[model samples]
Target: MKKQHIFQNALLTLLMLFGLAACQDREILTIENQSPAIVMDLSQEELFLDSNFPDNLALTIAWDVAKYSQPTELKYKVEASADESFEVPYVMGTVSGSQRVVSYTVGEMNKAAQTLGLTANEQGSLYFRVSSYIGEAGEYVTSTSNTTMLTITPYELEYPTFYLVGGATAAGWDAGQAIPLYKTSNMSYIYTYLTGNEPFRFLGQTNWNPLNYSIDQAGTRENYRYFKQVSSNLVQDGDENMKFTGTSGMYKISIDAATAVQSIEVEASPVAGWDFPEIYMVGSMNGWSATAPLTMAQVSPGIYEIVTPLGADAEFKFIGQKDWGDLEWGNILKDNHGYSGYVGPKGDNGNVKFVGNGGSYKVTVNLKAGTYTIVSQ
Candidate 1:
């Protein structure tokens, strides 16, 4: 009887151990609510964004923490949409673990609202939702918060920045020295000289790899006659660079990045006589006289350069002709506009005030960038 009793207790102990092991296994693998209940709250009812106070707090948003089946971290992504149903969503950013609040500056909200279909000066409803993921790109599991609505009135904002880089451009394949261009909405433009027979490409950033854009990637390129594809350099997904073949002058290159595939448009600029035969410097050096004016060398297209001497505070201007016949360049300084650098083609403009010691200076004028630089050796 004693032996039977001991065996019965041992059997009970074994069953208990097996049950505990099963419980631990369930704890390790179980995931609770793959789609958790979420609620989002907004700080303000409306946002009339101002350009003056761009950094001011435009809005604050908060959301409930997502519940995970296990003790796992949750990732959150902020998404905006014009439609409450979120048929289309624009991801503003991703918030990593435990950050339940997000603050938006006037500038940030303005850009988001405009991008989400809110027009300038007109108020419209914008929907915000937070998407929660168990881990890594929402690959495992995902849940979305209830949408929050806010009436937003966005102001017009200036800009995006793009760069020009390649063998065809003046920067010449140097990504660090890539020429910068400005973009307003969809169109980015720059007026620059292109070297013939050499291929050029646009860089989305100041880096060489990954984001470089060329003719083949730009898709339906317009004014392709101005560019000839480099057939010799072509391989499958290789260097599809485009060589400039247009008339030898400055050209306006524009890209519309908003397209399905970015589109390119090139055209001859209306700027005239920028690449003239004899550009002269007749300033304080020659008593501002037209006669015996120092001749500037045409270093490149639309670019004139001269190495000359001047006196301290000696002011002078560049005339298209020897006698200043309308086309001229001078100090383009004014009330919050124009460059501290040299500019031209202005009426009754101020003479370029020489700020440095009077010595031999290499003065370079780039009509492309609409500026000039005076460098002292």
Candidate 2:
């Protein structure tokens, strides 16, 4: 009897343990409603490249997830090739995410696609896919997101090659003449002229002012008129329709002949209506004022000229201020929108000239012996 009772008690205990474990497993299985679903949404279906960009470019992949119910981990796999089938992916990479929107860069894949002779807008395609995982006690469930495709295209940029004309290599200021803003069959071109502040007039032709002129599209080459200084509030394209708001001060610019300074000039002119103004020079070598200034004088009314002891290889720009409404303000003329020029050796003739409505100036610089690179603003 004692043995039977012990055996029965052990059996009952075993049954109870088994039942409790089964109930626990059932409760665990019912604890979570369902697994989360992840989704991906890319910003664009295609990527474009411009001539300025290399054959390979970086692409951005943005994605969004949905139905995320449980704490999940995500990983991304990008498979790309020249063929749509991706028989053999030329490029592959992995990423991880678990957020609603995840972003990834596809730079390596793009390069691999390019190596396969896949040009922009070609039939070749790149593919991307993502996988998500939800962890459980003993096992984890995985779900794969849909694949995304992107078509590559080309980008377009419109800017023409600018040319240089005349001037001394030693002098920083050289003349630039507009050869052709664009060589292609594009007719849309705008002109802008700039100048420092001062009172000066266009040289030559009394009625024809540097600030007076229009872009000529009909002619192959346009002649630029000289500039003279006169105190008048004239608006020009270089001003971007902004009125000259500067003080009246004599600013000067000096070029050193010994320094191989060939020529000194300014570019970008105000619109036609205003006269070139007078600008004086002030520098350390010139005592910092017009009175004690160097041999800074107006070569012509609008054009300030100076001869310096610096070598031809030296570089400097013309500085001055515009005189408007009794106040003197400084103005820094920009070349092709603030682009600097390449200065070369003196005695090498490469001069640039600017011939537009704003003003016509010549820059003669010797890039190499008997060789010149001229640019006109």
Candidate 3:
């Protein structure tokens, strides 16, 4: 009976241990589970940034802490885009802590405006969403808040410096007579004028000796073309120079020397009073919503320019007066809007497509010239 009593006590002890182990396992699973949801509250309905606002002033946004099924370290990102679809959103702010707030100063917001291709002094709509991430080193789960709208006017940008030279240019190879072009606040280059099928080149320095650039291929302006050759010694014997192959009229010439590989653009020159006061871009890049168009800057009279993000085989078109008015333009089913240029009516303008890969490119469109060019930067 003593032995039997001892066995019974041992069995009870084992059963108790099993019960405690089961409870501990359940607790561990509960602590590791997560279910995060975005809080709906946003700090402001309309965010205004003006020249009078202190450059250092910051725009702060607060939201409810995202919930999780288990204990988690959350990382947050504030995104802004031209459309509510958030297809090509920009990460305006990021935080990795318990805080659910994000802030951007007047300067930071202005930079973001420039990034979204917003023109100076023009009001545009921006979509905002807060993304939350939960996890440790190797694992993560993400949730996003409902998108909010912000109407803002960005300050004008400080453009870049450019000069025109070459025998085809109006100055006719005279470096002293070379025409000077204005730079956008974003630092791209532009010059507007008339040029026949003559050849022209750009001078890095205002002189003929040091750096003179020309397109490596004639009649090709859709891709990167700017090439520098101090002398015939720099290139092989048969290398070609960039020239004006399109018809001669008012022309808006654009250049992107911001990167190591330079690019060039030549489009029909806009004729003042004949063309719309403003032009905007709408297509796959911006969700193709006619209501929201990316405004183009008039670098010179009749000449409009914009730097927009493009995707692989991206397609888009120019909208006159910011709506689906009678003044729409698109590719003519030939040359792909490169040299053949574009044509239009109102409805079914078709799409101007890009065959190249994706990145932000400098696009120039000439209203009177009825021509355009998309140069990779």
TM of each candidate vs. truth: 0.50, 0.28, 0.39
Give the distance in Å from residue 88's predicted Cα in candidate 3 to where it truly belongs. 1.7
Cα RMSD, each candidate: 11.8, 20.7, 19.2
Candidate 1, residues 1-377, lDDT tens digits: the string is 99999999999999999999999988777667555536567889888888899999888888887776677777888888899998878887878867889888898888787766677888899998888876667666467788888888888756435677766676777899887764546656565666555667666679865555555534424322112232333212224456666555555666665422255666654453466666777777888887667888889876898998866766667766777576666654222132245353444236777766777898888775545778887
Which rank order by lDDT, best down to worst? 1, 3, 2
- Please, what are the lDDT tens digits per residue for candidate 3 over residues 1-377? 99999999999999999999999987775433244445455555565676566466556777777766666677877888888898777778777787777667877777677677676788888788887765543135467788778888877644335557765565677887665554433333332444555666666557764555555555534232454222221221223244565556545455554322345556553332325678888888888877898999988656688988787767787777667765566653323343234433344235787765677789898654344778888
Candidate 1 lands at a TM-score of 0.50
In candidate 2, how many Å is residue 272 off? 77
The lDDT per prediction is 0.68, 0.35, 0.62
Q: What ordering of candidates by TM-score runs from best to worst?
A: 1, 3, 2
Q: How many backbone clashes does candidate 3 have?
A: 11
* Tens digits of lDDT, candidate 2, 1-377: 99999999999999999999999986664234243343346666776554454534356554545334444455544445556565665435555554444343344444455544565445456666544444432134355556667776432223223221212111112222221121122111112222333222121122223332212223212443211221233222231121222332221221111111112222222222112344333333333444443333544433344444432232232223421222111212223211123221112112222223323223322111111122333
Error of 2 at 377 (Å): 42
Instruction: State the weakest 10-residue window (summed lDDT) of model 3.
Output: 229-238
